[model samples]
Target: METISKIELRNLQIEDYLELRASMIEAYSGIEDAPWKEHEIKKLLSIFPQGQLVVLADEKVVGCALSLIIDDKDIDDNHTYEEITGNYTFSTHNPSGDIMYGIDVFIHPKYRGLRLGRRLYDKRKELAEQLNIKAIMFAGRIPNYSKYAEEISPKQYIEKVRMKELFDPVLAFQLSNDFHVKKIMKNYLEGDTHSLDYAVLMEWNNIYYDKSPKLINSEKSIVRLGLIQWQMRPLKNLDALFEQAEFFIDAVSGYGSDFALFPELFTAPLMADYNHLNEADAIRELAKYTEPIYQKFQEFAISYNINIITGSMPNIIDGNLYNCGFLCKRDGSSEMYTKIHITPNEVAHWGMKGGDVIKTFDTDCGKIGIIICYDVEFPELSRLMADEGMQILFVPFLTDTQNGYTRVKSCAQARAIENECYVAIAGCVGNLPRVNNMDIQYAQAAVLTPSDFAFPNNGIKAEATPNTEMTLLVDVNIDLLKELHEHGSVRILKDRRTDLYEIKKK
Candidate 1:
């Protein structure tokens, strides 16, 4: 047997970064949505020029960890954080210590079998120690859209595919390396529609202040879901959308919700032929509108400290356009996602189709998945998010006809029951006409509990008006979603013929 020698990791040079940038784009080729761009690479390298490290094989850089030790002051003052002054900067400067942030950990596709991810991480931890850093944080993706269809319970849908793709292995490797998940960042990717990534915020401790004592007891988990249908006012412009969102958010902000969701297409002016515009052009316009809106929205979130899911819009990417969602925190940082699956009508006439992958975001509420419009139609989509330990799902959609609305409602309920999670859906009210004179009408928006469709549990708790602009505040108990999925008499996920299903795969 030919034995592979242990590889050594070294700090990447400027040339090495250029090489890694090429590799990162290549590695992400399998992704359906937007791929890594030159600018993102440049930005990362500019922040932490020396943070990147490469693993050598036969003296060649086969794998690398793209990390950055961002100075709190530098990052805070950076253009990215201009919306919120002093935001993202460490409030208390540790004059003697620095924060280690892992931007991305990537391995060359050809040399992945030898546990290069782990090797790179080991070196990463060592580097942190050598630097005497107080804490290490990194953003990680939870593969939600990469799931495959399986015959067993829905939870296995994404898990099975993730296992095959080594997504779980990467996560396990990180955990085994002693990286505790501090928080999950939601919808961090651009132009992604499905809930494909759950930004796993990881950390190693040092100089940051600790506010609370370590409790021996399990921390209480809470959930709040806000459902609102996107009501389009034809004459109403972007300002109207923002005003309506503010009004709705202010109205339901009192529910003490941890996370709230607005309907799909909630952010822009709806036109009969808006889809005819360049998706990116439309999104660029939306982003310009969103800049001021998000500025105030972030401040609103900061003031009320609320985490809000401001529904879907057409997002431009690399000159192409996509239907995407934006998750904004009161803290001024925002994550965006796009609709994965385009409807038959959308794909055939409008050049829109399915999204890239599944992604879940973390918030004060809990681990949640944001799926927009037609993307949620696929069971595999929701199942993938559920398998990744997501407690809640926020669906923003625009459906016409009571049949489609009911089908969506049923799908939401089924997703909750099969995955044993809570599902919230916000849809559009009134009639929305595409430029082609095609109009879709929605019956209502609803919030569903895990028990909504399962036995010993009844139907939907609350629903909005069928043809009116309305907001419904739904109280969600995250613990219940988490607890029921645990082994119980009504154990839905635990008892299954997981092994037998593989036979069918062959």
Candidate 2:
């Protein structure tokens, strides 16, 4: 059965979030903190049901405008994004509030340039008039501000936009609707690279309203992790290898993925540059390129707007060589994780040592943990990560045979179920000729969730073809993990008997 395409406007239902999410992913590609999570939407609807609305096309969610009635006393004249909506928990929403505050609005990219946004705005205005609000206020994002950020100040750029000399998609439309800038606020929406995290506190005074107040930007953070099941091949120089990695990062960014996972020792293919030396010296020589490659991946993370897990690399610290990797976050911050359970071959061939820490790292969405290759086989590290509140565990591995790959895969799934968290494992496939101790690999990259009604019955959300060189993009809801921890059929986390035995940190 085929449905006819027709545009319709109505109040947003809780069920509309999934469709709205896909539309939102397309609308804000290469932008972080773009899509709103279901729980946040539920909070808004429960707090102020009439303020949330949606636009549907042929029964598909294509556009939406979310809002809440708030009091100005709870918000300040110089408010940051966090202070406005009570850190996106929407705690500031008050039923007897004196102002009409807009939290979010966007149209599907495919349906853009058709004034759909204008229609949504008109509906919001009607609702404001109907309720008799004081005015409509929004901390509207300046999306185009980043283009000329180096050449012009934010205030000057806003002036140019207001003067009609320069056009800003959000601000221009807002200006047409009689909204004027209260002021330009800094770091209004954190990690909004396009806006340099700057936004205008805009307001359109209501003439027909008798009473009702204040809102800034509100974006819900969820993670879509994209894993690169890499193919081991020869590259002549560092530039070629970096170019290849950036290609995958670009592809992942286009999908609006929050993080990109690369396989363990994916950089091992570069060891060919020093293949003339003995195995230990050669791998150590490969370590020389680690810093440069990490620096380049950091640029990719920021420029492409995706966090990058630089699969395992060789790190020589204080004369001790370690199997290590780095997490290059999109917000220009980074973290490092080393393999805590180095394989026997690594110790024999490259003198690799296990790293000490098993800590959780924070991302824009939530806390995450990283383990390399053999680390997953040891349950203690993962338990330590889980104890530290890690929601997603990233495992970057290199396996030489089907048996090796199975060990990592099975253990990863077990970790997900037992820890009550998501686990994403990636590895290199094919062969890297002429590079000692890195000659062959077999991989089946996948993201595994806990076995629960909300998750897959078998616990695998997405996986790539065995031994294939491809990208596996999967969207895992952080809320699902939260739900599993709180109300799943088997509460693995809650059921752990610490009194019997426990794994304590040294």
Candidate 3:
């Protein structure tokens, strides 16, 4: 029986070359090909450190997987092994390549039945995904085919192996690991006598590979935005409020909305329960709901597969009351953005203190930023976010009059054009007379865009009816913004005369 052993997988170090070579000799003895040299392993580590990995049992190297990245166009089934390895020079390794090309993988003969090779393959797949590489490709040998050399052709042997009539160790393992044969080549490795200089081209595509980088820099070209202009009304209970929020989330998710934005302090309706206390005390009490609501948003974000901008809610930190927003992503990950600007009414009535932190949040769809209500009126805030590559800006507000709503709406529109990005606004629009300091509301949820020929002339992608409770759905083309940044008639972002005047956080 194969004995169990504790093992550690890590990047191959140059010092372990002797032990790795010993393992290779035990596994590939009597081969007609050249084995990896100490210099070659050292070069691989120097060029692509993460690709060269080794597995150890009790700190002794037992297996290794060496790989390099290459351009997709460089992949060819009828190529020699040396061609891919840059004639053993590994000059073919491209830093910004699209494919993870496996140069060599082997496990010691004594550790054969331990499934260590599978661990190496799985790690390679993970690295491929992390680097956004398209696929993992390699040329695999048929070591067992030497026994039937005279009786069957290499293709015939492969067919029999696939049909379970024969078992070729390397070919069987590759197949079980979801690798598909791309082509069969002859003389792939002149030293591989067991394979008779024959090899099978195999590939495992990375399903998570964002060909254009779905995260980080390369964002989805088109994203559907949904804004829920919540109505300030009575709440039967907290569960009732969540169920209502879920209804909108499920509705928007059904429409394939990538994000759902709720109004600022949409949770304020719950403040009705604390009406007996002063406005300051009521808001502080509302802060206690932050944890549960934040957690619930995470749950709905995952279940509905939509990123959520949880508007803003009353929150307490270090015994100070503040308004905070949350970014709940579909992948069960989340981030927080505090309201950086405070209103006079908030300070006078609720004693709310503004947050000092400001930054952008990364989502699966794109990079975004949040500046609740009054913060949107500040041009410096959006400019800072734009400088950090924030492609979408969200503003969740609560206003009780047309004058206050206009202040947020007009400034939000200006932010979109000046930042060369998309701006989405949502706010409460109804009366919650029972909720103190939230007796009335006014809003016109809208998705604003930069003013360009590719966008709406008026800069409004879509807007809800004024002073109404509804949802505004809009699809913004991020590619247009990318183009506008370089080719638009008015290049606001690029034309900035930073040499003379600029905005910076102190």
Candidate 4:
């Protein structure tokens, strides 16, 4: 005897007919049967290839299961196997049928005693769930019934098997696999003497069936994004920052936005009075308010019932200055992502260093990635987040010129297309006349989507007036991203040449 190395179950293909036919012939060798022609198998495949399946061990076809879809209402009260299936021609396969009718399950003689039948049944159940059908139904053979046909009727024989007082090589196996006997059928098969031409109608209901398009595109499947175009004004103190933050929170939460985002270093206004200090000292002064800002945002998130990505704040942790963004959840819990890419101005002027770790945050809406300003300019950072199952990318940026703003905007749009994910960018606008290194700001808040028919014409779902002090809110459908990855005109995520090159994160 040889051991099975690996088993693979897949949809039936026309090329599998030769091996499947041979297996069917061998499995029904000593029983009365009509051989299935090649055209019949091809017809079945042409109608619904998903309903037919084959199991392979080391590339050898050892088991097969065939099925067809049918409407339950069309099945008559006293339907025979031939009447229900059109004498095995399968011309009755209804594409919109709610019930999946299992036509046959056969295992090669050499593959017997290996529990291959169980594998075939499991595959059928999987197909039912994928199609979101009502139930799996078929007429099961009572193979050992011929021996006891004179002792009892078919219904009585089935009851004994159900009661465990008798054994049915076929019905017992079907029952163990959760198929309940609905009733007995007479003359179910044309030439089945072993079963005395009697079979049991069986069904396995799919209790978890769901097939509504609204359910797929519901609010449960969307992530509402709120982008804040912060006004670059002089901040007298942290109270001024609080006033502006509360205003945006109140405005966006009124519309039920899930995540509210602010611009990078939006809290820099809090250090407006310390502008007389050197550039490095002034940024460090902003860092001192990081703890208080984090605590305030945490409270705001709970009070407004929204998750707040408080943009990027300067943090002087362990004597090293880093740009960090906090994601405060509605429950008052928060996490932070440090900017992994530092700009030339950041390093030369503010003595800022880049972070080492790249991560994504899990929320009620979806998995999100927070990348700040220049970090979005690097493709690998967004790719890493996408690989980690980030369906939405949030960028909090601060740029003083239109050229710098374009860099962030273009890269953000490109990332959305490449990864097939939503990207929301928020930035600061207006002139902070007194704050060094942040005196001038050029900003626009926009929600960018992949370039597809399901999306907007310019790949932007929503945007604020350039350099305006306003909040932009947009609802992004995560399901649309899923559909694009599967059925878009150009599936960038699925068409990646992983064999040629891969994105490996260290």
TM-score for all models, in order of appearance: 0.52, 0.61, 0.60, 0.58
Rank candidates, TM-score, best first: 2, 3, 4, 1
> Residue 225 deviation, candidate 3, in Å?
0.6
lDDT of 4 by residue, 400-437 (tens): 99999999999999999998999999999998777887
After superposition, the stretches of candidate 3 with alpha carbons farther than 4 Å from their true spots are 1-219
Instruction: Tell me the deviation in Å of residue 176 in model 4.
Output: 55
Candidate 1 error regions (>4 Å): 1-218, 268-296, 432-440, 452-456, 502-506
Which of candidates 2 and 3 reaches a greater lDDT?
A: 3
lDDT agreement of model 3 with the native: 0.88
RMSD of each: 20.6, 16.0, 11.6, 18.0
lDDT of each: 0.60, 0.85, 0.88, 0.85
How many pairs of residues collide in each model? 26, 5, 2, 0
Minimal lDDT window, size 10, model 4? 211-220
Q: Name the candidate, 1 or 4, with the larger lDDT value.
A: 4
Best by lDDT: 3
Assess the local accuracy of residue 315 in candidate 4 as a C-alpha lDDT between 0 and 100: 92
Q: Can you write out model 3's per-residue Cα lDDT over 166-251, one digit (the tens) per residue?
A: 99999999997889988889999887878888999999998877767755333357899999989888997889889989999988
Per-residue lDDT of candidate 1, residues 229-333 (tens digit) = 667656456566567777777667656555667777655454433566654343445544544654556545533446778776655566665676678864346
lDDT of 2: 0.85
Model 2, range 122-233, lDDT digits (tens) per residue?
A: 7787677667677789899889988998999988998999899999999999997778889888878788888988899999876765432344213333579899999989
Error of 4 at 46 (Å): 49
